[model samples]
Target: MSGDPVAGVTAKTFGQLPDGREVELYLLVNANGLEMTVMSYGGTIVSLKVPDAQGNAEDVVLGFDSLEDYLSPAYRSANPYFGAIIGRYGNRIAGGQFEIDGTAYQVPTNDGENSLHGGDRGFDQRLWQVSAVDAKDGVGVVLSLVSEDGDQGYPGQLETQVRYTLTNDNALDIRYQATTNETTPINLTQHSYFNLEGEGGVEGQSGILDHILTLNAEAFTPVDEGLIPTGEIRSVEGTAFDFREPTPVGSRIDGDDQQLQRGKGYDHNFVLADNASDAKNGSDAEGLVLAARVEAPQSGRIMEVYTTEPGVQFYSGNFLDGSLVGKAGQPYEHRSGLALETQHFPDSPNQPDFPSTLLSAGETYKSHTRYEFSTR
Candidate 1:
C-alpha cells in the first residue's frame, strides 16, 4: 500500500459511487515521499500525510476513507466545503438569479430560495476526468472538468483544469485555470479546511477562535442569515473582523452585530489588498501575501494561507456538531474546525461594488491559492 513515496505514485479505487460508477483516487507522493490522496469525487484531497516539527507525519485535512463515507448519512464524511473544487460561480446568488448584459438567468435555489455553492449540484458533487498523472511534475494527477454553458444555472461553457501538485517542501499547491467560450462570470476555488492535527469532524479539537490570524485587509463584506452579502464592505477596525495582526478569533466573535448572527458565527468575506490585480498580471508586487496564519499551539503546527484572490472567507465552523467521526476516530463538533477560504467576495455577481468575478471570451481565468505548513 506504500506505493513508491518518492516517485510516481499510483492510482486505485477505494470504492464505487452509489450510481455504480467508478471513482478514481490518485496518491501524489512528493519528492520527499510524503503522501497526499486526491479523489475524483469533488476533486477532494482525501488525505495529506506530511511531517510536522516533530518529524511525525499525519493526515492534516478532514475526510473519510470510502466513497460511501461521502454518500452515506451515517458518518457525515461529507464536507459542504472540504477540499472540493467549487464552481463556475462559487458562492451564493441571492434569490437564485443574477443579471448579465441586461438579461437575467434563473438559477436553482437549493439554500432557502437562494443559490448556494452553485446549487445542490455544484462542482463538489461531480466526478471529473483525470487529465495528467505525471509523477514527473510531482502532480500525481490533474483533474479536468468541462461545465456546459447552462450547467448548474450558470452561463458559458467553461473548460476548467485544476492541478494539484505536492512539493517536497510539504506544500500542496493548487492552481486553477479556466477559459470560457462566451461572456460569463467565473469564480473558481478549492474549499479545503485545515485542522493541522490530521483529524476530521469538529470534536476532540479545541477552539480555533483563540488561534492567531493575520489578514491583509481593512474591510470586509457583512452578510445576512443566508450568508449572502448585504452589498456593503465594512471596515474591520474595532470589530472582530480585523486580522491585520495575529489576533484571537473569540475576542469579538460574540459581538451582537447583525452580520455575526447572519453567519451564525464568523462567516464573513475579507476584502484582500487591491494588489490582487497586480499579482494576477504577474508583476513583482506581493500578490500572494500572508492572508492568514493559524497556529495549533498544543500540536506545534503552524499554517499560513497565501493567494492572489481578492478576499478570504474566515469561517469558524460555527455549525459543526460532534455527530461526525473523523479518520483519526474523533467526532467533529462546533468551532473545533476552522476554514480560511480565499476567493473573491461572496455574492459578487450581484454586488456592483465588489471586485468582478467575471470572465470573457479569450481571457483565461487563473487563480492560485497556497497553503504553506511549518513548525512553531
Candidate 2:
C-alpha cells in the first residue's frame, strides 16, 4: 500500500458483489489535474477525465457509474467489454480450441462458435487484489490476479499484475506483467472505449464518426464470418482499412467492401509496422512504437497510442446500441466510441504464421501501452 501522504491516489468503496466481496475504486490524479477512476472489480477503468482545447476536463471513456450496472443482467447480456482488462487471450480463438506442444485444449465458446476474450468468465470479471503505488513519475494502482491451472481451460498457474499510472505529462500508462508455472498461451489488453469528444459527444451529436484516426500500419488481418482471423495478413492499400494518414473514421466505413460488410464497421486487427520488426528482433528499447492516433474536432482533444505490442485491434463500437445507459444516464449508441487495443494478433494460437503467444514455464510476459492526451 502507498503510504505517501502526498501521493496523488485515493480510494473509496465502489460497491459490493453478490458474494459480499467489496470492490474498491481508486482515483489516480496526475500533477496536471488529469483524473482516472478505476475499480477493483474487473480491473476496470470506470472514468478518465482529460482536458480539451479550452482547458475543460471531461470524461472520455464509456462506463457505468456504479458497480451494480456492471453486474446488471442487461449489461451482462450486452457485454460490450467497456473499459475492462481482457486477458489469457484478448481476442477470438477458432472453435474455442488450440494446441500447445501437441496437446489439445478446449476453452469455453462464448462468442458464437469461437472463444472470445478468454471464454465466458475472463479476467474482466475477476475481482483483483489492488494496492496503491507511488511511482517515481506519477501515482498509480497495481492490480494482481492468480489464475489456477485449468481455470478457463488454460494449462498454467498464471500470476498476473497490471499497473495503471497517471503521469504528470498527461499520459495514462498501462503495464502488464505475467508469469506461468506451465507453458501456456497468453494475451492481455485493456479495452477502453474512448470518445475524445466526451462520452456521448459534443453538443447533441453522438457517435465518433467525425473523429480523425491514423494507424501506423500498412496491413490488417482479415476475419471470417465468425469474426475470427483467417490467418492472412493482407495489405490495406486501396481499401477502406487504410488509415495511414489522418482520415475521418466514417469516411469509408460503409464502403462496398467484403471486410467492411463482415465487420459491420471497423472491427479488425492491424499489424503494427513499426513494432513488428523490432519485436521479432528482440529489440526491447525500440519496441515501443506509435500504434495509433485519434483526434476529435468537436473537443479538440487528441490521443496518441504507443505500445510494445505487435498489433492493435481497432473497434469502432460496431455493436453498441442504445440499450445500455452509461455515465450521466446517456445511452450508448452505435459508433459512439472507439477502442485501440494494443495486443498480439488475434487467433495467434491457431495461426501458425503469426507470432507465438506461448509463455513457457518460468518465463515472464511483459507488455506496455501508453495513451497520451493533448489538445491541438
Candidate 3:
C-alpha cells in the first residue's frame, strides 16, 4: 500500500457482492511504482497497474466493475480463472470420468461437455478467506480456504493456502500449498492475462509479434478438439509449436494444422525443460522451472515464469471473438488474450504416463510460480 496518494485511491474493506457475500480486497504497491488490487473473492486480482516507458501506469488485466460484471457470463465469471487461484484440478477431464486405484469416478462437466478447471463449482468462483497480510514484506497477502468432502466430485476435505507477494523488484510471487485427508488429485495455478501494451493487447499493443518467446522444451502434448491433451508429446522442431527462436506468434498461425483448428489457435501444453543437470535442484525444483518467457519489444516488459510443475499451457485466446468489450471499450478479439498456465499436464489424473498430480494423505502438495517482470 503506497501512501503517496492518488485521488479516489484508498484502502479499506469494500464489502458484500450481489450474493450478499463479504469479500476483502488487498491493494499492493511494488517498489517500482507498480500497484495491484487483490480480493478474497475467488482470491482474484481485481486490477494490476504497471507503468510504461513514459512512467504512466495502466491496468493490464481484464476484470469487471460492480458484481454484475462478475455475475454476467460475458465477464467470463463462470471460468473463475480471471486472475483467480485455480486448484484441486486445473484442467479438463474426459467426459468428467477418470480412474484411480482401479475405481472410476465421474465428475460433472462445466465447460461445454468437459470438466474444466475444478468443475462447475471450482475454487475460482468461491470466496476465499483473507488469512494474513504482511506489509513489512512488501505487501504479501495470504489467502486460505477449505474444500468440503465431495466438493466438485473430488474426494477429501482439502485445505489450501495461497500467498501472493508484490515484491520490491517489480515482480509478483505466487505460492500454492495444500493438503488432503484422502487420496485425491490436485493441481493449482494462477490465470492472469497480461497485455504489456495495456488496454487492448494488439494493434497499439506494446508488445510486437516479434516478441521473443523461448520455451525450454523439445516437445508438447497434442490436444483434441475439446482442448484436452491427447497424451502425445510431439516434437516442436518443425511445427508452429516451436519457439526455439524468437519467432513472431503469427508467423506459423496460418499454417494448416488440425490442433490449431481444434483450438482455433495455440492452446496446447508444452513439456517443461528438464533441469536434471542440477540433481540437487531436481527434487525441490519439482515444479516447472524457467518454463517460458514472453517479452514485449516496445515496453521492454519481460515475463519470465518459474514453476515446479511439468508443463506450461500457452493459450492464444482463440475463443475470444471480439464479442466482449474490454477495458476502454476495446473489443477483446481473437488472440487478444493469452493465458500462460503452469501446472501438471492436463488430465494428469486420467493419464497414467503423465506426472502424478495425486496427493495422498500425509503428502504435502506445494508449488511455487513466479511471474517476474523487468525491462530488457
Candidate 4:
C-alpha cells in the first residue's frame, strides 16, 4: 500500500502460517488504477479490482478475505482451486500414471481415478519466494519455487518461476518459466475463478450463466465418465460444445450431450485453432493469439484471453454449492465463478496426438497467457 497510483508495486505482510512462516501480499497497480493483489502463499492472486463501464472499480475474482479461511478443513476438502497456480501438470493425468523413456511413474490420484492439478499438495499449496519486478510496460511481482526430485512423485528437480504483471493498458500478463534436471511432464496454469460482475450478489444468486463467451476453437477433447479425455479430438460443429460465436454460457449447458453430462457443465478443454509454432516461447507479443473472450453484459465488463498455449479449459464453477463463503461474506453458489485455464491438453502424457508437454533435461519450458480487460 506504499506505492504511487501511477503504476507501482508494494508488498505487505498478509499472514503467518501455523508453522510460523510469514506470507507476503504484493500489490501491483497499473496506470489506469487497475489493481491486482498476489500473495506468496501458493503464489495466489488474492483479488483483482477492475473498472466497469461507469469507471466504478470492484473485485472481479472470487477468493477468501483471510488466510485462515483458505486453511480451513472445509476449504481444503472442496479444493475449488480458487486463484492459485497449478503446476507439474495443470489438468488431469489418467490413472495418475505415465511413462517416460520406457520408465513408468505414478503420482497420487486425488480426482477419482485420475491425478488432478499436480498431487493433493501441488504448487497451489506451497509457499513461493516473491519479489517485486519492473516490467517493460507494467509493474508486477515474480514468484519462484523449486520442487525437489520425487516431490509430489514427479521426476526431476524442477525450478519454476511465474510472473504476474499488471500493464498500463489494463492487462494482466502471466508468464511461466521452468527448467528440470531430468525429463518430465510440465504443464502449469493459473486457476482464477472470474465472474466479471464481481464476487457475490444478492441472496447468493451470483452465477456466470449470463455471461457471453466466444472461443476461437473449432474442436474440443471430450471426456469420459471420470472427466478424463477420451483421446478423440472431436469437432464442436452442430453440438453444444460450439462457442465460435458469442453465445450465452447457459445456452446449451443442460443439453442431453454426454460430454455435458460427464462434466455437469462447460468444463471441457477447447483446442485453440490459432496455434502458431513460432509463439511457443511467448517471448514476442505478436506471437500470442486470441483464445477466448468473455463478456458480462450487466457490468459492461469484458475479458479477452490471449495465450500461446494450445488449449483452454473453460470451467463453469460446477462444484460450488453454497458450502463456502467468499470475501464478501456470501455463500458461493453453483456457477458463481468460472475459470479459463490456458495450457496443454489434459492427459497429454497418455495421448500422443495431443500437444507434447515433455520438458527434457537442459531445456526450459515457457508459456504466456494474458487477460485484457475493457468495456464494450
Most lDDT-accurate candidate? 2
Model 2 weakest 10-residue run by lDDT: 278-287
TM-scores of the models, in the order given: 0.91, 0.96, 0.90, 0.96
Off by over 4 Å in 1: 1-4, 74-79, 133-137, 200-207, 274-286
lDDT of 3 by residue, 14-118 (tens): 577777877777777755557888888788887787766666677777665444556567666434366777866887877887877887777778877788888
Pairs clashing within candidate 1: 5-33, 59-198, 201-332, 202-332, 202-333, 203-331, 203-332, 203-333, 209-249, 320-334
TM-score of 2: 0.96
* Candidate 2 lDDT tens digits, 1-376: 1332343899999999999999999988877778899999999999998988998889999999999999999999999989999988999999999999899999999999999998899999999999998888988999999999999999999999999999989899998888898989899999999999888566666589999999999999999999988889999999999999999999999999999999999999999998765452112343568999999988899999999999999999999989999896888899999999998898999987898788888677888899999999
Instruction: Tell me the alpha-carbon RMSD of every candidate.
Output: 3.0, 2.9, 3.4, 2.2
How much lDDT does each candidate structure score?
0.75, 0.90, 0.73, 0.89
| Candidate 1 lDDT by residue in tens digits, 204-298 | 43656656677788888878777888888789898767788877667777788777877888888888865444433112233566677887655
RMSD over all Cα atoms, model 3? 3.4
For residue 44, give model 2's deviation from the true position in Å. Answer: 0.2
Best by TM-score: 2
lDDT of 4 by residue, 1-376 (tens): 2443556898889899999999998889887789989999999999999998898788999998888888899999999989999988999999999999999999999998889999988999999999998788989899999999998899999999999999989999999999898988999999999998888753433489889999999999999998889999999999998999999998889889989989999889999998723323223334588999999988889999999888999999999999999988878889999999998899999988787888888788888899999997
User: In candidate 4, what residue range of length 10 has the lowest lDDT sum?
Assistant: 276-285
**What is the TM-score (0 to 1) of candidate 3?**
0.90
